[model samples]
Target: MSTPSQLSTNADLRILQRNMAAALMQPLTRHDGLQSRTQVDFITPNDRLSGFQRLEIYARQYWFRLLDCLYDDYPALRVLLGEMRFHKLCRDYLAAHPSTSWTLRNLGSQLSAFITEPKARDVARVEWAQTLAFDEPQKKTLHIDDLLGADPSALRLGLQPCVIALRIDHAVDHFITAMKKTDADVRSGASQAMSQAPTRAAIIKAPRLKKEVLHLVIHRHENTLYFKRLTREAFLMLTALRDGLTLADAVELALAEADPTTDWPVQIRDWFAEWSQLGWFCKPSPQP
Candidate 1:
Protein backbone atom coordinates (compact mmCIF):
# COMPACT_ATOMS: atom_id res chain seq x y z
CA MET A 1 0.00 0.00 0.00
CA SER A 2 3.05 2.30 0.36
CA THR A 3 4.52 4.56 -2.35
CA PRO A 4 8.13 4.18 -3.52
CA SER A 5 9.41 7.07 -1.34
CA GLN A 6 7.61 5.73 1.76
CA LEU A 7 9.00 2.23 1.23
CA SER A 8 12.50 3.67 0.88
CA THR A 9 12.14 5.59 4.13
CA ASN A 10 10.94 2.47 5.96
CA ALA A 11 13.89 0.50 4.64
CA ASP A 12 16.29 3.23 5.72
CA LEU A 13 14.79 3.23 9.20
CA ARG A 14 15.28 -0.50 9.54
CA ILE A 15 18.89 -0.18 8.44
CA LEU A 16 19.47 2.59 10.97
CA GLN A 17 18.01 0.49 13.75
CA ARG A 18 20.01 -2.55 12.83
CA ASN A 19 23.22 -0.51 12.65
CA MET A 20 22.54 1.10 16.01
CA ALA A 21 22.01 -2.26 17.64
CA ALA A 22 25.23 -3.60 16.22
CA ALA A 23 27.09 -0.49 17.38
CA LEU A 24 25.79 -0.90 20.90
CA MET A 25 27.16 -4.40 21.14
CA GLN A 26 30.53 -3.68 19.55
CA PRO A 27 33.61 -3.99 21.75
CA LEU A 28 35.10 -0.67 22.70
CA THR A 29 38.75 0.19 22.06
CA ARG A 30 41.33 0.50 24.83
CA HIS A 31 40.89 4.27 24.77
CA ASP A 32 37.11 3.86 24.97
CA GLY A 33 36.66 4.75 21.33
CA LEU A 34 33.83 3.20 19.42
CA GLN A 35 34.83 0.29 17.18
CA SER A 36 31.47 0.50 15.53
CA ARG A 37 30.31 -0.59 12.11
CA THR A 38 27.50 1.95 12.14
CA GLN A 39 27.77 4.90 9.79
CA VAL A 40 28.93 8.14 11.43
CA ASP A 41 25.96 10.12 10.16
CA PHE A 42 23.53 7.74 11.78
CA ILE A 43 23.71 9.81 14.95
CA THR A 44 23.83 13.59 15.11
CA PRO A 45 26.83 15.34 16.66
CA ASN A 46 25.98 17.52 19.64
CA ASP A 47 27.88 20.62 20.78
CA ARG A 48 29.55 18.79 23.68
CA LEU A 49 30.15 15.44 21.98
CA SER A 50 30.74 14.06 18.50
CA GLY A 51 28.31 11.54 17.04
CA PHE A 52 30.75 8.71 17.56
CA GLN A 53 31.35 9.84 21.15
CA ARG A 54 27.62 9.69 21.88
CA LEU A 55 27.39 6.24 20.32
CA GLU A 56 30.42 5.14 22.34
CA ILE A 57 28.67 6.17 25.57
CA TYR A 58 25.68 4.01 24.63
CA ALA A 59 27.90 1.06 23.65
CA ARG A 60 29.88 1.20 26.90
CA GLN A 61 26.71 1.43 29.02
CA TYR A 62 25.10 -1.44 27.16
CA TRP A 63 28.09 -3.70 27.68
CA PHE A 64 28.51 -2.64 31.31
CA ARG A 65 24.90 -3.52 32.13
CA LEU A 66 25.26 -7.01 30.64
CA LEU A 67 28.61 -7.45 32.40
CA ASP A 68 27.11 -6.43 35.73
CA CYS A 69 24.31 -8.98 35.33
CA LEU A 70 26.83 -11.78 34.78
CA TYR A 71 29.05 -10.55 37.62
CA ASP A 72 26.14 -10.69 40.04
CA ASP A 73 24.83 -14.00 38.75
CA TYR A 74 28.19 -15.79 38.98
CA PRO A 75 29.59 -14.49 42.26
CA ALA A 76 31.29 -17.76 43.13
CA LEU A 77 33.05 -17.80 39.79
CA ARG A 78 34.17 -14.23 40.34
CA VAL A 79 35.71 -15.16 43.68
CA LEU A 80 37.35 -18.28 42.29
CA LEU A 81 38.83 -16.61 39.21
CA GLY A 82 39.74 -13.32 40.88
CA GLU A 83 38.36 -9.99 39.63
CA MET A 84 40.67 -9.42 36.67
CA ARG A 85 40.44 -12.94 35.28
CA PHE A 86 36.72 -13.12 35.89
CA HIS A 87 36.14 -9.89 34.05
CA LYS A 88 38.20 -11.16 31.16
CA LEU A 89 36.23 -14.37 31.10
CA CYS A 90 32.97 -12.45 31.09
CA ARG A 91 34.09 -10.34 28.16
CA ASP A 92 35.24 -13.39 26.27
CA TYR A 93 32.04 -15.26 26.98
CA LEU A 94 29.82 -12.37 25.99
CA ALA A 95 31.77 -11.96 22.78
CA ALA A 96 31.26 -15.61 21.96
CA HIS A 97 27.64 -15.87 23.09
CA PRO A 98 25.99 -12.47 22.96
CA SER A 99 22.60 -11.83 24.51
CA THR A 100 19.77 -13.31 22.45
CA SER A 101 16.90 -13.09 24.90
CA TRP A 102 15.00 -9.95 25.84
CA THR A 103 15.22 -10.82 29.54
CA LEU A 104 18.59 -10.80 31.26
CA ARG A 105 17.46 -13.73 33.42
CA ASN A 106 18.76 -16.06 30.69
CA LEU A 107 22.04 -14.22 30.17
CA GLY A 108 24.12 -16.70 32.10
CA SER A 109 22.09 -19.75 31.19
CA GLN A 110 24.85 -21.09 28.99
CA LEU A 111 27.74 -20.11 31.29
CA SER A 112 28.13 -23.50 32.91
CA ALA A 113 28.85 -25.12 29.55
CA PHE A 114 30.99 -22.21 28.36
CA ILE A 115 33.41 -22.45 31.27
CA THR A 116 36.27 -24.94 30.83
CA GLU A 117 37.70 -24.97 34.36
CA PRO A 118 36.45 -28.04 36.20
CA LYS A 119 35.96 -26.41 39.60
CA ALA A 120 34.67 -23.18 38.17
CA ARG A 121 32.30 -25.10 35.91
CA ASP A 122 30.90 -27.00 38.89
CA VAL A 123 30.42 -23.79 40.85
CA ALA A 124 28.70 -22.17 37.89
CA ARG A 125 26.41 -25.17 37.52
CA VAL A 126 25.33 -25.02 41.16
CA GLU A 127 24.85 -21.27 41.11
CA TRP A 128 22.84 -21.41 37.89
CA ALA A 129 20.68 -24.22 39.29
CA GLN A 130 20.02 -22.16 42.38
CA THR A 131 19.01 -19.29 40.16
CA LEU A 132 16.54 -21.52 38.32
CA ALA A 133 15.19 -22.92 41.59
CA PHE A 134 14.58 -19.46 42.93
CA ASP A 135 12.92 -18.22 39.75
CA GLU A 136 10.87 -21.23 38.57
CA PRO A 137 7.26 -21.64 39.67
CA GLN A 138 6.30 -24.10 42.44
CA LYS A 139 3.36 -26.39 41.82
CA LYS A 140 0.78 -27.71 44.26
CA THR A 141 2.39 -30.09 46.74
CA LEU A 142 1.23 -33.69 46.25
CA HIS A 143 0.60 -35.02 49.72
CA ILE A 144 0.78 -38.67 50.74
CA ASP A 145 -3.00 -38.80 51.11
CA ASP A 146 -3.41 -37.97 47.42
CA LEU A 147 -1.80 -41.30 46.64
CA LEU A 148 -3.79 -43.39 49.11
CA GLY A 149 -5.75 -45.16 46.35
CA ALA A 150 -3.07 -45.04 43.67
CA ASP A 151 -1.69 -48.36 42.46
CA PRO A 152 1.89 -48.89 43.63
CA SER A 153 2.87 -50.93 40.56
CA ALA A 154 2.02 -48.24 38.02
CA LEU A 155 2.40 -45.06 40.13
CA ARG A 156 4.22 -42.23 38.37
CA LEU A 157 5.25 -38.93 39.95
CA GLY A 158 6.58 -35.58 38.96
CA LEU A 159 8.98 -33.43 40.92
CA GLN A 160 8.13 -29.81 41.69
CA PRO A 161 9.11 -27.43 38.91
CA CYS A 162 11.59 -25.71 41.17
CA VAL A 163 13.36 -28.93 42.06
CA ILE A 164 16.70 -29.73 40.35
CA ALA A 165 18.77 -32.86 40.83
CA LEU A 166 22.53 -32.60 40.39
CA ARG A 167 25.43 -35.01 40.58
CA ILE A 168 28.73 -33.17 40.68
CA ASP A 169 32.28 -34.09 41.67
CA HIS A 170 33.05 -31.28 44.10
CA ALA A 171 31.65 -29.81 47.31
CA VAL A 172 30.68 -26.67 45.42
CA ASP A 173 27.53 -26.34 47.50
CA HIS A 174 29.58 -26.00 50.68
CA PHE A 175 31.83 -23.50 49.00
CA ILE A 176 28.81 -21.55 47.74
CA THR A 177 27.26 -21.58 51.22
CA ALA A 178 30.41 -20.04 52.62
CA MET A 179 30.45 -17.42 49.86
CA LYS A 180 26.82 -16.57 50.45
CA LYS A 181 27.21 -16.18 54.20
CA THR A 182 30.21 -13.94 53.78
CA ASP A 183 28.33 -11.84 51.23
CA ALA A 184 25.38 -11.52 53.57
CA ASP A 185 27.61 -10.34 56.40
CA VAL A 186 29.28 -7.80 54.14
CA ARG A 187 25.87 -6.58 52.97
CA SER A 188 24.74 -6.25 56.60
CA GLY A 189 27.85 -4.14 57.40
CA ALA A 190 29.11 -6.72 59.89
CA SER A 191 32.71 -6.10 58.82
CA GLN A 192 34.32 -7.21 62.04
CA ALA A 193 32.23 -10.39 62.18
CA MET A 194 33.05 -11.23 58.59
CA SER A 195 36.74 -10.64 59.24
CA GLN A 196 36.66 -13.29 61.96
CA ALA A 197 34.96 -15.80 59.68
CA PRO A 198 37.89 -17.73 58.20
CA THR A 199 35.87 -20.05 55.97
CA ARG A 200 35.66 -17.67 53.03
CA ALA A 201 39.37 -16.91 52.82
CA ALA A 202 40.41 -20.45 53.67
CA ILE A 203 38.37 -21.94 50.87
CA ILE A 204 39.44 -19.28 48.38
CA LYS A 205 43.17 -19.75 48.94
CA ALA A 206 43.18 -23.54 49.00
CA PRO A 207 45.28 -24.76 46.05
CA ARG A 208 42.76 -27.42 45.11
CA LEU A 209 39.40 -28.50 46.42
CA LYS A 210 39.18 -32.02 47.82
CA LYS A 211 36.98 -33.84 45.34
CA GLU A 212 33.77 -35.18 46.90
CA VAL A 213 30.89 -36.78 45.00
CA LEU A 214 27.62 -35.01 45.73
CA HIS A 215 24.06 -35.93 44.80
CA LEU A 216 21.97 -32.90 45.63
CA VAL A 217 18.42 -31.69 45.28
CA ILE A 218 18.19 -27.94 44.85
CA HIS A 219 14.68 -26.67 45.51
CA ARG A 220 12.67 -23.78 46.80
CA HIS A 221 10.54 -23.83 49.97
CA GLU A 222 8.51 -20.87 51.21
CA ASN A 223 10.38 -18.51 48.87
CA THR A 224 13.79 -19.67 50.10
CA LEU A 225 16.20 -21.80 48.08
CA TYR A 226 18.10 -24.68 49.66
CA PHE A 227 20.49 -27.49 48.75
CA LYS A 228 19.44 -30.85 50.16
CA ARG A 229 22.09 -33.56 50.14
CA LEU A 230 20.90 -37.05 49.20
CA THR A 231 22.36 -40.54 49.19
CA ARG A 232 23.25 -41.85 45.74
CA GLU A 233 20.42 -44.36 45.93
CA ALA A 234 17.79 -41.77 46.65
CA PHE A 235 19.14 -39.41 44.01
CA LEU A 236 18.97 -42.08 41.35
CA MET A 237 15.43 -42.98 42.33
CA LEU A 238 14.30 -39.37 42.13
CA THR A 239 16.01 -38.99 38.78
CA ALA A 240 14.26 -42.03 37.39
CA LEU A 241 10.89 -40.77 38.61
CA ARG A 242 11.64 -37.39 37.08
CA ASP A 243 12.33 -39.11 33.77
CA GLY A 244 8.78 -40.57 33.66
CA LEU A 245 9.48 -44.05 34.98
CA THR A 246 6.84 -45.79 37.10
CA LEU A 247 7.46 -45.60 40.84
CA ALA A 248 8.12 -49.37 40.93
CA ASP A 249 10.61 -49.05 38.10
CA ALA A 250 12.27 -46.04 39.75
CA VAL A 251 12.72 -48.04 42.95
CA GLU A 252 14.24 -50.93 41.04
CA LEU A 253 16.74 -48.58 39.36
CA ALA A 254 17.79 -47.17 42.72
CA LEU A 255 18.23 -50.62 44.24
CA ALA A 256 20.34 -51.69 41.30
CA GLU A 257 23.04 -49.16 42.27
CA ALA A 258 22.49 -49.46 46.03
CA ASP A 259 24.80 -51.16 48.48
CA PRO A 260 24.09 -54.86 49.08
CA THR A 261 24.15 -54.57 52.87
CA THR A 262 21.84 -51.53 53.12
CA ASP A 263 18.20 -52.20 53.93
CA TRP A 264 16.93 -50.21 50.91
CA PRO A 265 13.28 -51.16 51.37
CA VAL A 266 13.15 -49.34 54.66
CA GLN A 267 15.36 -46.54 53.39
CA ILE A 268 13.12 -45.85 50.37
CA ARG A 269 10.07 -45.75 52.59
CA ASP A 270 11.78 -43.19 54.81
CA TRP A 271 12.85 -41.15 51.78
CA PHE A 272 9.31 -40.94 50.41
CA ALA A 273 8.01 -39.88 53.84
CA GLU A 274 10.65 -37.19 54.14
CA TRP A 275 10.22 -36.02 50.56
CA SER A 276 6.44 -35.82 50.92
CA GLN A 277 6.79 -33.69 54.06
CA LEU A 278 9.17 -31.42 52.16
CA GLY A 279 6.57 -31.02 49.36
CA TRP A 280 8.80 -32.36 46.60
CA PHE A 281 6.19 -34.33 44.61
CA CYS A 282 3.55 -33.16 42.14
CA LYS A 283 1.05 -34.64 39.69
CA PRO A 284 2.78 -35.59 36.48
CA SER A 285 1.75 -33.50 33.51
CA PRO A 286 0.02 -35.36 30.66
CA GLN A 287 2.23 -35.66 27.60
CA PRO A 288 0.80 -34.64 24.25
Candidate 2:
Protein backbone atom coordinates (compact mmCIF):
# COMPACT_ATOMS: atom_id res chain seq x y z
CA MET A 1 0.00 0.00 0.00
CA SER A 2 3.07 2.29 0.44
CA THR A 3 5.92 3.29 -1.92
CA PRO A 4 9.57 2.71 -0.95
CA SER A 5 10.09 6.42 -0.14
CA GLN A 6 6.98 6.46 2.03
CA LEU A 7 7.74 3.14 3.72
CA SER A 8 9.36 3.26 7.16
CA THR A 9 10.30 0.93 10.04
CA ASN A 10 10.57 1.82 13.75
CA ALA A 11 14.30 2.33 13.34
CA ASP A 12 13.81 4.74 10.42
CA LEU A 13 11.22 6.75 12.33
CA ARG A 14 13.46 6.88 15.42
CA ILE A 15 16.38 8.16 13.40
CA LEU A 16 14.19 10.83 11.83
CA GLN A 17 12.93 11.99 15.25
CA ARG A 18 16.45 12.03 16.66
CA ASN A 19 17.74 14.14 13.78
CA MET A 20 14.90 16.64 14.14
CA ALA A 21 15.44 16.90 17.87
CA ALA A 22 19.16 17.48 17.43
CA ALA A 23 18.49 20.20 14.88
CA LEU A 24 16.04 21.99 17.18
CA MET A 25 18.36 21.78 20.17
CA GLN A 26 21.56 22.77 18.44
CA PRO A 27 22.96 26.23 19.16
CA LEU A 28 22.52 28.96 16.59
CA THR A 29 25.56 30.28 14.73
CA ARG A 30 27.09 33.67 15.62
CA HIS A 31 24.95 35.39 13.03
CA ASP A 32 21.85 33.48 14.18
CA GLY A 33 22.31 30.88 11.45
CA LEU A 34 21.61 27.19 12.00
CA GLN A 35 24.60 24.96 12.60
CA SER A 36 25.65 22.61 9.77
CA ARG A 37 23.44 19.53 9.79
CA THR A 38 21.70 17.12 7.46
CA GLN A 39 18.37 18.90 7.58
CA VAL A 40 17.93 18.51 3.77
CA ASP A 41 17.36 14.79 4.26
CA PHE A 42 14.01 15.37 5.92
CA ILE A 43 13.32 19.06 5.32
CA THR A 44 12.29 20.26 1.85
CA PRO A 45 13.63 23.55 0.47
CA ASN A 46 11.15 26.11 -0.90
CA ASP A 47 11.28 29.28 -2.98
CA ARG A 48 11.28 31.71 0.00
CA LEU A 49 13.04 29.59 2.62
CA SER A 50 15.69 26.89 2.39
CA GLY A 51 15.49 23.66 4.36
CA PHE A 52 17.95 24.94 6.96
CA GLN A 53 16.12 28.28 7.29
CA ARG A 54 12.84 26.46 7.87
CA LEU A 55 14.48 24.40 10.60
CA GLU A 56 16.10 27.51 12.04
CA ILE A 57 12.67 29.00 12.64
CA TYR A 58 11.73 26.24 15.03
CA ALA A 59 15.17 26.15 16.62
CA ARG A 60 15.24 29.88 17.33
CA GLN A 61 11.69 29.80 18.65
CA TYR A 62 12.55 26.88 20.89
CA TRP A 63 15.64 28.60 22.27
CA PHE A 64 13.90 31.97 22.70
CA ARG A 65 11.08 30.32 24.60
CA LEU A 66 13.56 28.69 26.95
CA LEU A 67 15.51 31.93 27.43
CA ASP A 68 12.29 33.77 28.31
CA CYS A 69 11.56 31.14 30.95
CA LEU A 70 14.96 31.59 32.55
CA TYR A 71 14.41 35.35 32.59
CA ASP A 72 11.09 34.91 34.37
CA ASP A 73 12.51 32.43 36.86
CA TYR A 74 15.63 34.38 37.77
CA PRO A 75 14.88 38.09 37.64
CA ALA A 76 17.15 38.91 40.53
CA LEU A 77 19.96 36.92 39.01
CA ARG A 78 19.58 38.95 35.85
CA VAL A 79 19.75 42.16 37.85
CA LEU A 80 22.87 40.98 39.64
CA LEU A 81 24.62 39.92 36.44
CA GLY A 82 23.26 42.75 34.26
CA GLU A 83 21.43 42.17 30.97
CA MET A 84 24.24 41.12 28.63
CA ARG A 85 25.95 38.93 31.21
CA PHE A 86 22.62 37.29 32.08
CA HIS A 87 22.09 36.38 28.45
CA LYS A 88 25.56 34.83 28.31
CA LEU A 89 24.84 33.04 31.58
CA CYS A 90 21.64 31.60 30.19
CA ARG A 91 23.36 30.36 27.01
CA ASP A 92 26.24 28.83 28.94
CA TYR A 93 23.97 27.29 31.55
CA LEU A 94 21.69 25.79 28.91
CA ALA A 95 24.64 24.42 26.96
CA ALA A 96 25.82 22.66 30.10
CA HIS A 97 22.35 21.69 31.36
CA PRO A 98 19.67 21.33 28.74
CA SER A 99 16.01 21.12 29.60
CA THR A 100 15.50 17.47 30.53
CA SER A 101 12.25 17.84 32.45
CA TRP A 102 8.88 18.03 30.75
CA THR A 103 8.08 21.23 32.62
CA LEU A 104 10.04 24.48 32.23
CA ARG A 105 9.64 25.15 35.96
CA ASN A 106 12.68 22.96 36.60
CA LEU A 107 14.82 24.67 33.94
CA GLY A 108 16.84 26.76 36.36
CA SER A 109 17.13 24.09 39.04
CA GLN A 110 20.84 23.79 38.42
CA LEU A 111 21.57 27.48 37.79
CA SER A 112 22.79 28.22 41.28
CA ALA A 113 25.34 25.47 40.98
CA PHE A 114 26.44 26.77 37.60
CA ILE A 115 27.02 30.34 38.78
CA THR A 116 30.53 31.08 40.05
CA GLU A 117 30.20 34.57 41.54
CA PRO A 118 29.35 34.33 45.23
CA LYS A 119 26.91 37.23 45.25
CA ALA A 120 25.23 36.17 42.04
CA ARG A 121 25.16 32.54 43.18
CA ASP A 122 23.50 33.52 46.46
CA VAL A 123 20.86 35.54 44.61
CA ALA A 124 20.25 32.67 42.20
CA ARG A 125 19.80 30.29 45.10
CA VAL A 126 17.27 32.55 46.79
CA GLU A 127 15.36 33.20 43.55
CA TRP A 128 15.24 29.47 42.75
CA ALA A 129 13.94 28.72 46.25
CA GLN A 130 11.24 31.34 45.75
CA THR A 131 10.27 29.67 42.49
CA LEU A 132 9.97 26.29 44.18
CA ALA A 133 8.10 27.76 47.13
CA PHE A 134 5.65 29.38 44.76
CA ASP A 135 4.94 26.13 42.89
CA GLU A 136 5.12 23.46 45.62
CA PRO A 137 1.77 22.09 46.73
CA GLN A 138 0.61 23.02 50.20
CA LYS A 139 -0.43 20.44 52.80
CA LYS A 140 -2.63 20.66 55.89
CA THR A 141 -0.76 22.98 58.25
CA LEU A 142 -0.33 22.19 61.95
CA HIS A 143 -1.90 24.85 64.15
CA ILE A 144 -1.02 25.54 67.79
CA ASP A 145 -4.04 23.62 69.03
CA ASP A 146 -2.86 20.48 67.22
CA LEU A 147 0.24 20.33 69.42
CA LEU A 148 -1.58 20.56 72.75
CA GLY A 149 -0.45 17.92 75.26
CA ALA A 150 1.84 16.27 72.68
CA ASP A 151 4.96 14.46 73.88
CA PRO A 152 7.93 16.61 72.88
CA SER A 153 10.46 13.79 73.29
CA ALA A 154 8.77 11.38 70.86
CA LEU A 155 6.51 13.31 68.48
CA ARG A 156 8.12 14.21 65.15
CA LEU A 157 6.80 17.12 63.11
CA GLY A 158 6.96 18.09 59.47
CA LEU A 159 7.21 21.44 57.75
CA GLN A 160 4.85 22.70 55.11
CA PRO A 161 5.77 21.52 51.60
CA CYS A 162 6.20 25.14 50.47
CA VAL A 163 8.64 26.07 53.22
CA ILE A 164 12.24 26.58 51.98
CA ALA A 165 14.92 27.40 54.52
CA LEU A 166 18.18 29.03 53.49
CA ARG A 167 21.27 30.29 55.28
CA ILE A 168 23.34 32.64 53.15
CA ASP A 169 26.43 34.78 53.79
CA HIS A 170 24.91 37.99 52.40
CA ALA A 171 21.62 39.81 52.87
CA VAL A 172 20.45 38.77 49.43
CA ASP A 173 16.84 38.71 50.58
CA HIS A 174 16.94 42.42 51.37
CA PHE A 175 18.60 43.08 48.03
CA ILE A 176 15.93 41.17 46.16
CA THR A 177 13.16 42.83 48.13
CA ALA A 178 14.57 46.19 47.22
CA MET A 179 14.82 45.19 43.59
CA LYS A 180 11.20 44.02 43.54
CA LYS A 181 10.01 47.22 45.18
CA THR A 182 11.96 49.27 42.69
CA ASP A 183 10.40 47.33 39.82
CA ALA A 184 6.91 47.94 41.19
CA ASP A 185 7.59 51.61 41.74
CA VAL A 186 8.99 51.95 38.24
CA ARG A 187 5.89 50.36 36.78
CA SER A 188 3.67 52.69 38.76
CA GLY A 189 5.78 55.69 37.88
CA ALA A 190 5.58 54.89 34.19
CA SER A 191 2.25 56.72 34.06
CA GLN A 192 3.89 59.89 35.38
CA ALA A 193 6.90 60.67 33.16
CA MET A 194 8.46 62.94 35.80
CA SER A 195 8.47 60.20 38.48
CA GLN A 196 9.57 57.44 36.11
CA ALA A 197 13.02 58.89 35.46
CA PRO A 198 14.05 59.02 39.14
CA THR A 199 12.56 55.61 39.83
CA ARG A 200 14.69 54.15 37.02
CA ALA A 201 17.71 55.95 38.42
CA ALA A 202 17.13 54.40 41.84
CA ILE A 203 17.50 50.91 40.34
CA ILE A 204 20.88 51.74 38.75
CA LYS A 205 22.10 53.31 42.00
CA ALA A 206 20.80 50.55 44.28
CA PRO A 207 23.07 50.02 47.28
CA ARG A 208 25.22 46.95 47.69
CA LEU A 209 23.87 44.42 50.19
CA LYS A 210 26.05 44.12 53.28
CA LYS A 211 27.67 40.77 53.99
CA GLU A 212 25.91 39.06 56.90
CA VAL A 213 24.83 35.57 57.83
CA LEU A 214 21.07 35.53 57.25
CA HIS A 215 18.68 32.70 58.09
CA LEU A 216 15.50 32.95 56.05
CA VAL A 217 12.37 30.92 55.55
CA ILE A 218 10.60 31.33 52.21
CA HIS A 219 6.98 30.16 52.49
CA ARG A 220 3.66 30.72 50.80
CA HIS A 221 0.37 31.52 52.56
CA GLU A 222 -3.03 32.26 51.05
CA ASN A 223 -1.34 32.24 47.62
CA THR A 224 1.19 34.93 48.58
CA LEU A 225 4.87 34.24 49.15
CA TYR A 226 6.75 35.67 52.16
CA PHE A 227 10.33 35.80 53.41
CA LYS A 228 10.60 35.40 57.18
CA ARG A 229 13.91 36.07 58.93
CA LEU A 230 14.80 33.85 61.87
CA THR A 231 17.32 33.72 64.68
CA ARG A 232 20.19 31.28 64.25
CA GLU A 233 18.82 28.92 66.92
CA ALA A 234 15.28 29.04 65.53
CA PHE A 235 16.61 28.33 62.05
CA LEU A 236 18.50 25.30 63.32
CA MET A 237 15.49 24.01 65.26
CA LEU A 238 13.11 24.38 62.34
CA THR A 239 15.55 22.65 59.97
CA ALA A 240 16.00 19.87 62.52
CA LEU A 241 12.24 19.36 62.74
CA ARG A 242 12.05 19.28 58.98
CA ASP A 243 14.71 16.55 59.07
CA GLY A 244 12.31 14.34 61.09
CA LEU A 245 13.82 14.87 64.52
CA THR A 246 11.53 14.82 67.55
CA LEU A 247 10.76 18.21 69.10
CA ALA A 248 12.87 17.77 72.27
CA ASP A 249 15.84 16.42 70.36
CA ALA A 250 15.54 19.15 67.76
CA VAL A 251 15.44 21.81 70.45
CA GLU A 252 18.43 20.27 72.20
CA LEU A 253 20.44 20.22 68.98
CA ALA A 254 19.45 23.79 68.17
CA LEU A 255 20.40 25.11 71.59
CA ALA A 256 23.73 23.27 71.66
CA GLU A 257 25.36 25.90 69.43
CA ALA A 258 23.32 28.86 70.70
CA ASP A 259 24.57 31.64 72.96
CA PRO A 260 24.78 30.46 76.56
CA THR A 261 23.44 33.68 78.09
CA THR A 262 20.14 33.68 76.22
CA ASP A 263 17.02 32.30 77.93
CA TRP A 264 16.31 29.66 75.26
CA PRO A 265 13.30 28.08 77.02
CA VAL A 266 11.25 31.23 76.63
CA GLN A 267 12.63 31.77 73.15
CA ILE A 268 11.69 28.25 72.13
CA ARG A 269 8.10 28.68 73.30
CA ASP A 270 7.83 31.99 71.48
CA TRP A 271 9.30 30.52 68.27
CA PHE A 272 6.91 27.57 68.38
CA ALA A 273 3.86 29.81 68.84
CA GLU A 274 4.94 32.15 66.03
CA TRP A 275 5.73 29.34 63.62
CA SER A 276 2.49 27.57 64.46
CA GLN A 277 0.52 30.71 63.63
CA LEU A 278 2.40 31.00 60.32
CA GLY A 279 1.28 27.40 59.56
CA TRP A 280 4.84 26.29 58.83
CA PHE A 281 4.47 23.01 60.72
CA CYS A 282 2.74 19.88 59.43
CA LYS A 283 2.41 16.27 60.47
CA PRO A 284 4.81 13.86 58.79
CA SER A 285 3.60 10.64 57.17
CA PRO A 286 4.30 7.57 59.28
CA GLN A 287 7.17 5.37 58.10
CA PRO A 288 6.35 1.89 56.88
lDDT of 1 by residue, 24-112 (tens): 77775655457855555667798999898887777777776777678667777877788767778887888888999877778899998
- Model 1's alpha-carbon lDDT is 0.76
Residue pairs clashing, model 2: none
Model 1, residue 53: what's the lDDT?
A: 83
Compared with the true structure, all predictions reach lDDT values of 0.76, 0.78
Error of 1 at 42 (Å): 0.6
Candidate 1, residue 262: the lDDT equals 85
**Candidate 1: regions farther than 4 A off:** 1-10, 31-33, 36-38, 181-208
